[model samples]
Target: MNSNYSAQEKNFATALLHNLWKYLLLAASIVATVKIIFFGFDIDE
Candidate 1:
């Protein structure tokens, strides 16, 4: 029973990390877009 609970907790932690990464990527993309809009598309660096 303890092992089962531990497995569930691990699953939850993995899922949480996955979701956090998803949101981080989304936020990064949004920031990049905003920067492009503000600075123009001259990202030729």
Candidate 2:
């Protein structure tokens, strides 16, 4: 039972980390887009 619980917890942690990275990247892209649109910041520059 203990081992099973540990495995489940590990899986949950992995999923949470994955989701965090996904959202972080999404937010970064949105911010970059907004900057480009309003401030004329070049992404390549």
Candidate 3:
């Protein structure tokens, strides 16, 4: 049915957005770790 398809489409869109956010967070975390390592922050802390 049209309604069922619509709901499935909406769920797929939500999942895509969720994955995008997850990747963004992972990238940010990696950048932060790199920054800290470059600054030698881990040696003291």
Candidate 4:
């Protein structure tokens, strides 16, 4: 029973981490796009 509980806890943690990274990547891309739109970026300069 304890092992089963631990397994379930680990699964939940894995899912949480997965979602966290997904959202973080999504947010980072959005922020980058907004920054580029508003402030612009210069690679050649």
RMSD of each: 4.0, 4.5, 4.0, 3.7
lDDT of 1 by residue, 2-39 (tens): 99999999999999999999999999999999998877
lDDT, candidate 3, equals 0.95
The CA-based lDDT of model 4 is what?
0.91
Off by over 4 Å in 1: 41-45
lDDT of 1 at 40: 73
Task: Report the C-alpha lDDT of model 4 over 1-45, residue by residue, as the tens digit.
Answer: 699999999999999999999999999999999988767546434
User: Considering TM-score, where higher is better, how would the candidates rank from best to worst?
Assistant: 4, 1, 2, 3
Q: Which digits, one per residue and each the tens of the lDDT, describe model 2 over residues 1-45?
A: 699999999999999999999999999999998887866555445
Residue range with the least summed lDDT across 10 consecutive positions in model 3: 36-45
- Residues 3-37 of candidate 3 have per-residue lDDT tens digits of 99999999999999999999999999999999989
TM-score against truth, every candidate: 0.78, 0.76, 0.64, 0.80
Q: Which ranges in model 3 have alpha carbons more than 4 Å from their true place?
A: 41-45
Candidate 1: which pairs clash?
none
In candidate 3, the residue pairs with backbone N, CA or C atoms under 3 Å apart (3 or more residues apart, or in different chains) clash, namely none
Instruction: Report lDDT (Cα) of residue 43, candidate 3.
Output: 73
Candidate 3 residue 38 Cα shift, in angstroms, is 1.7
Count of clashes in candidate 1: 0
Q: Flag regions of model 4 displaced more than 4 Å.
A: 41-45
